[model samples]
Target: MSILSALTLSRRPATGFVIVGIFWGGFAAHVPVLKAQLGASDALFGLLLLGTAAGLVSSMWLAPRLDRTLGARGMQVAALALALAWLFPGHMSVQVLFFVSLIFVGGASGLLDVTMNARVSDLEAQTGRSLMNANHAIFSVAYAVAALISGVTREAGIPPGWVFTGFSVVTILLLPVLRMAPAAVEPEVGYAGAYPLWPILLSGLVVLVAFMSEATVEAWSALHVERTLGGGAVQGALGPTMLGITMAVGRFSGQVVAERLREVPVIVGASLLSACGVILAAVAPVPALAYIGFGIFGLGVSVVAPMGLALVGKLVAPHLRTEAISRAAVMGFSGFFFAPVFMGLVSELFGLRAAFGGVALLALCAVPLALALGRYPLRTAQIRP
Candidate 1:
């Protein structure tokens, strides 16, 4: 294939990442509107958010089978499902209906997450390239862009329903773009067989820690700035904004080094830096210092999930890659599910500072796991190039 063809094929997965980022960024900006629409208190809103995690975790169980059966088509189908579900939440007036809508939305996100990663990993295996960090970097950049735009529109008094409608249209428009690339095929095996459970569990553990640390910052950093440091709303918003910008920069840097550096050192160094960042945030005397800490934290944690996923991709046999990734995603995303709740509970008991300290601890937990993953030799498979 020519260079143009390869570049086009590579872009398909990155486009999916951008769409996912748009949903999440817009969703974050719209949370206040949804709360007002439903008149939900803090506890009630947390429960409603929990439904998404429940749906996400539950749907992950089926994602592997879906991908296995449909191959690349599974990603397109899930993205469509996510896009359609995206529009429903904006229209929901009843609490029950809204809760149910989130379930569908989360389920689609879960499936799309697994399918897209599997597809990207397949593409990397086929091309002998390091694509995961670059794809994830695009995700971070899209997220930052969407959040900034949504913030502006929210300030202009735009209804979230209108914003969501735009997202739906864009998502649908991207379907043909997703279909531009040929489907990735599972590499042939001598006989159909099961993948070993250990690698999945180990890699999944690292992902869980990485995601939990990241989610803690995203969910609570603003609160930490406002409540703990007595900052104004503008200062509070800077918390996540700084983190997002630094995260994009970090992942972009990772894209350049991913192929050259071994996964272990990358993960180990990133985790340690993330741990120190959270610790600094936990101890910072002022909001400005906390912002710097969060920036450091974002920079450190940015490359972790991509590196872990790439390592898992390298470890598994090609034919079994989808299944292994599904298992790992289930573990990884559980952190996304529970991290905020965990932080909330800790904050309630000990205060937000201690809660952030707990996040730093979680980052440190990944260090040993990264070392273990380093010990596993990469398995070579015959794949298309």
Candidate 2:
């Protein structure tokens, strides 16, 4: 399907993606300020972010059930929750409180993440169109826009609290568009079948690796530009802005690529390209070169998680899609939270450059996981006598 058609088919979920992206992009651009406010060392800051990891894991586990219970209003409820949750972190100056605030932020984000992705998968199944990449591209576009705006706000000396509050209002305003259609009922099968654990596990692992690499950049690229390369606040914000913009371009291109290429080859090639980009970013001596590296990395890694999630939807039974996706998301989304900790510890010991190198290594690991997916059997054993 064309990108426009795919977007239209999954517009509600796409809006959810945009909401999530806007919050994260703005937060990412403000990471330097947040860390400074807490007076946190790299190690301590990483540990604090573990609060988010805890919340994300717990909420993701509950997502399928929550989605079922909320039905058509799932997205709206989740979005509103996230809007409120984000308000705490920016307003907090205490380390403990900041950590606590992240927990709420992470939980709300995880809830929305699973719900929206599942919604997109449902649309893809219903329409027989590959919509995952298109919907995710909307997220990348929104993220880039938010990052730029946040940068401008930061330059104007606006505090993160007001910036977050503004974005929260924007999210609340979009609530109406997040209403989903009622999910169609599935036909009952004669016997309960074993869940397709293998595909979900494999796809989840691929997504985990992809997100780990992606998150490392989102969380630390600004620091790399500002502290490591001696850039100003606007320049630091540009780090993630560059990544978001390139990722949008990459994901939009991936929509077309998905129509023509096999999944395994595409993932494998993209992983290698991302690895190269990370290595270059790690080694770059100047902010401009680092931006180039980030751009290249964003272009390559943009499609990996979306494709991984799409693979799970394609491999699992329709009746189990929501549960399967929730399980996979728990695994995948953990990477998003854990990565900051990983980078922080590494940065504390070795420096941001070495931490980025570690990310490059993580990117390369996706190749083998993608190959495993290629060899896995296609027939999902959804039922057994």
How would you encode candidate 2's per-residue C-alpha lDDT over 1-385 as one tens digit per residue? 4989889878899999999999989988999999999999988988888888888889999999899899989999999999999988987889999989999999999999999998888877776667888888899999999998999999999999999999899999999999995457364467376778889999999999998899889989998999999999999999999999999999999999987886788899999999999899999999999999999999999999999998888787777888888888889988966798889989999999999999999999999999989976543333211
Report the C-alpha displacement of residue 37, candidate 1, in angstroms: 5.2
Instruction: Pick out the ten consecutive residues of candidate 2 with the lowest summed lDDT.
Output: 376-385
Q: After superposition on all CA atoms, what RMSD does each candidate show versus the true structure?
A: 3.1, 2.6
lDDT of each: 0.79, 0.89
The true-versus-predicted C-alpha distance at residue 319 of model 2, in Å, is 0.5
Error of 2 at 245 (Å): 0.5
Which segments of candidate 1 are over 4 A away from where they belong?
1-9, 31-44, 90-96, 180-194, 230-234
Q: What is the lDDT of residue 100 in candidate 1?
A: 92
Could you estimate the TM-score for every candidate? 0.89, 0.96
The digit string of per-residue lDDT tens for model 1 on 167-214 reads 888999998766533344546656564665777888999889988888
Model 1 scores worst on lDDT over the 10 consecutive residues at 1-10
